[model samples]
Target: MELILKTPIGLEKIAADRLIEMDREISLSVKPHGLEGLIVVERCSDKQALVNYILKNVPEVESLVNVEVETEANLKSIVDAARKVSRGKISEKESFAVRTVRRGRHDFKSIDVNVAAGAAVQEETGAYVNLDHPDKIVQIEIIHDRAGISVTNGFRWKKMSPDKKPALNFFNKISIVQMPYLGSLEGAKEVGARIGRAVQAYEVRELVIAPNKPVDAYELNKFIDGVIEGIESRFRIQCKSYDRKVEKVRVSVQDLYQLVRDRSGEPMIVFEPEGIQLIEAATKLRKIFEEADRVNYLFGSREGIPKGVYRVASMVIDLAPGITLPTELAAPTALASTYTVISMIEQNIEDN
Candidate 1:
């Protein structure tokens, strides 16, 4: 008949008062015996109604937990209580974990309780332990003299952890080879600026302006100026936003054909209509990205990349089968596609 609620340190009295006024059947104490930020309901008529009211109306409280079974604060007692609560609720086919949060000082650490209880639950239920992505979680909330044990479903939304391979780690190895978008000087500058921002958002290693053929000299100069401007503006924001050191993307210029011949050792990927479907090349692309130290992504301006260059390239990817993306959309899409398939590949590798 006890429910524990958590609030800001000084607001525990206010939260307890509100709860007391709702139902006279409950007797409660705010910050029981000088512990801060806790409201302990010694007796209550309805636990479900109180939980619903707090969630709908109470803004002062930060967290709330319903105590299923109250046992003496000791390792053996805690393990037996958890086993009783976890009976037919969890199956052996599902993965599970034990999470302990201890509030008061004791002879044993929180990890000790977790290990003892976890082993008991595993033996009783015959379920496997998956700490990172568990299907169910046995919650242990331990106070100074008493412990609360409950079994809840595990949260499965967290995509990145120390054990999981992050897709962002692979972005720094790519060099974007973009052709000069020539025509009007003003239009070229605008296109170049957008592409610059898109590529630098991921903090890619390099952005190479590669003109496969002769283009307007004035238009090229304006485009180059805009690229530099866009990079600095975005880099400044990144430096302020991120806690770690931020690196500006390197800008370089090399003719598309010569650059391919020079960096023949690296993997070169071209985005064009004549190439194979993305579904078909995804596995091969994942292998190339995993093994190579550097990857080159070639994108066209107004005209597509020359057909001759496709032969020497490692893979030609038609990202969208029937549709051609705009110049600005193309760079970001290429990066997104690369990250999506590679993440799936790494997850599969770990799973198998």
Candidate 2:
């Protein structure tokens, strides 16, 4: 039976092994419970076969923990499904909450009246607009003459720790540059130089600056100059404005196949394509986040991911030149290998 075990970062290998062994083990002495089951993940292939094997051999095994066992390749769909099941909104404060409403459907005309009444009764301005911690997200499902009104907070809330957090500020920079609302070119340059120095201190290969809004072309140029002057050899800085427009990213599965097939080439193109793909996927994922409720299955077209399976398949493909992969896709690849199970998982998540 094959199982793709999912774990948080910084998990120990020994614990992972124990979890894997719980499915099946050759030696009963290893377990205090004297339980034994044997399953070899020879390759990261065939999810159904693995599921059937586990269910047939272990009748008590209703579901596997940590591992996402699905028949389809589209993980984005899975996320969307789960999200629908756990519908809620994320606040600017980085918190998730659920809403419920008693009414079936609300009319804007009536809603305005209610808002005005609420403001008048509450003796507060903008009380209607300030729908913080809304009592409910009113949902109305009308069927014939009968209607179903649901006030739902589907998913439970848990505080995500800061350590497990992904980078929030998408603008990848060594440091932040602060200037007055209308600062001078020198100020921009100084900010860029500080960022460059910070990037050098951190030993990063590249530093990027993303202005919140478009800047004067000359001022932007001066900022780049300061960034270039501050960094040492092998470090460079780039400045660009944040793109508000949504963009579509394309990747040839064949091109990725060939690149992973050849990892030792000069100017190692491994990082570039993967980074671009990830960025594009991230952007798309962000869009889906807006319509998270109605999103049924987030499958990419042929130009992108066909299903969750495509990204998973990419994970199995040889990432390093002339290298072998482990039975457990979660296992680490060769030290020299640029590909990793975690990397593939993250790619799938971002693509989703």
Candidate 3:
């Protein structure tokens, strides 16, 4: 196979139909050999043209792999195939990794092929092995006795790799102190749940419910209950989907004024209309976020923060001047803006 097209499962037929319509000379198989979600290009008048067409025209195709070698799916054959394709493709200055995907029964497991083929490729070409962030990837697609092998530039989307301290990681360092929305029990609960999900979406260092004045006990309880429910549901999905250990967002209640007092030494940012715009504070905020042990952010609900608290805050920010955000949007907007500013800071550092 010159190229293998991957589509969402059950969309293989649509991918094939589009390919045939693009060029009558191109020959391929949909779901080749009973495999699902795969189309193999057997022959094409112009391989490059077909690849370009597939990329631009085929919306259903997820990715297209250009196969360099088609060989028997034995360990020895696989190793030989990998070594043959990788001869001068990689160098010692670059790193490569062998990724094997097996779709049928075989005596040797996928790891066995990775080890044998990786060692073989490494022995033949003096390239380094960096599985986490390889410069090149030797892809192995095995289907029972038949296997297709290819070399490709690795995907560069693993922003959370340990070697990288990505901007998103800073979310862990932020502490969001938001005043709970207090009104009808239903409205309070609904707003609380939205705020809770927003907080846990980042899994921030801490989420503080800061009430400025007396609130109805039933309303507060309902809001807290909804917050708990929101945290639980989102945390469940994160636990199942996240690769690392997911920490459920911590919930705490604090009086608005007291919280400002207690976190006086740390960097505290209050969001309010009277405060400086986010753009103006970005430079200062960058330093605070990067240096502080925990950066506290205060978002008001029904009533704005006590003007007194702004004086004690390290920096007061108006996320959006003139336009007031809805109750649920306040914290999320803060999170997104912080993420953007820090990313800009990192970019500046890199550019320098």
Candidate 4:
């Protein structure tokens, strides 16, 4: 399960650092999915303490939106419910019928009932139906001989993953830095240094800098280099730095496919065989992040995903115009510095 942390207006680096430190103090672990996006933190335990911890620590939080929780029972129920809801038949009754499906935990909340009214009647159809998309959803509750029905006029839930949404729409005006050679750590230090310098120079603290490969033996190296060289080479600040080991490694599409027998189980790709090389280049980003051993920490997006409710400080950078990412992918902000790089400082919600 994941919790989202949202900071729509903006935040600073110290604020972000404080939030992250506070999250740890609250016993919450956060993951950074992207900049200018929500920070997603995993709920390690099934107990409600995770939510309580976040609510207790995060003060500027707006709301906590639990995207979805996948458990053995939930997986089974989701599969069964989806099949049942999608395959069921919709019938016209004596003017009205309301149906409700419980989702998430029973103790927290369940899906409200969807009701339809009118004098239409269909003799061939049954009561079983699919309410995936509906115009009106009504909530009904019965207790102690008293019944409550909430009539929500129009509310639509988004059931698709963030990747499935139109990328351009979701990432509008955001600058993306794509490092296709993230498979190794050779140049990670340089890349991290440049990225940090760019971010700091640009005055934006939040950033999305993926290594060129899924696992960079050099990701920490590059971060260390960036922190050290960034101060002397890029900025005039004097600072000490070193690499922190990553427990897990990130993977590229090709590496992922090579490592896994079932590529279909992972995210679906639409490119043809001729575009395989391009796809490989597009998905090559390492997922290793260990905080630095210095006063300032340079977190790796490929490794250390951000936690929830924390504010991120991003330095803005513009990918050169006409520059193409590996496999012909293009950064949305390639032409301008409109996009802001982000790093999370708190845990309030998970990235959707």
Best-matching candidate per lDDT: 3
Which model, 1 or 3, shows the larger TM-score?
3
Candidate 3 is scored at a TM of 0.88
Please give the ranking of all candidate structures by TM-score, highest first, separated by commas. 3, 1, 4, 2
Task: Give per-residue CA lDDT, model 2, range 1-352, as digits (tens).
Answer: 1332222333323433553454443221121122122122323344565556555654433323212222221223222332333233322223222221112233323344334333332232111222444433222222122222222332324344332443322212111212211248887666555544544433332333333344567776776666566554223322222223211111111223333234222121111112233323434434433333211111111132222233423122223334332211101121112223334445678789
CA lDDT, candidate 4, residue 299: 28
TM per prediction: 0.58, 0.19, 0.88, 0.22
User: Which parts of model 2 have CA positions greater than 4 angstroms off?
Assistant: 1-136, 154-244, 248-352
Return model 3's CA RMSD, one decimal: 2.6
Q: Please give, for residues 246-306, the per-residue lDDT of candidate 4 as tens digits.
A: 1111112223223223322322212112222331222121110122111111122332212
Q: Write model 1 residue lDDT over 200-297, tens digit each, in one string.
A: 88888899999997877899998998888888888889899876787889999889899989999889999998888887888888888779888999
Q: Residue 38's C-alpha lDDT in candidate 3?
A: 86
Tens-digit lDDT track for model 3 on 1-352?
7898889999998889898898898888778779899888989988899889988888898887888999998999999999999988888788999999898899999999999999998998899899988989999998778889999997755647665565446888899998889989999999999988988888898899989888899999999998988899899999988778888889999888888878779988888888888889988888887688898988888887788887788988888899898988999889988788878777789989
Q: Which ten residues in a row have the lowest lDDT in candidate 4?
A: 285-294
Clashes of 2: 11
- For model 4, the local distance difference test gives 0.32
Ranking by lDDT: 3, 1, 4, 2
Runs of candidate 3 exceeding 4 Å displacement:
161-164
Global fold similarity of model 2 (TM-score): 0.19
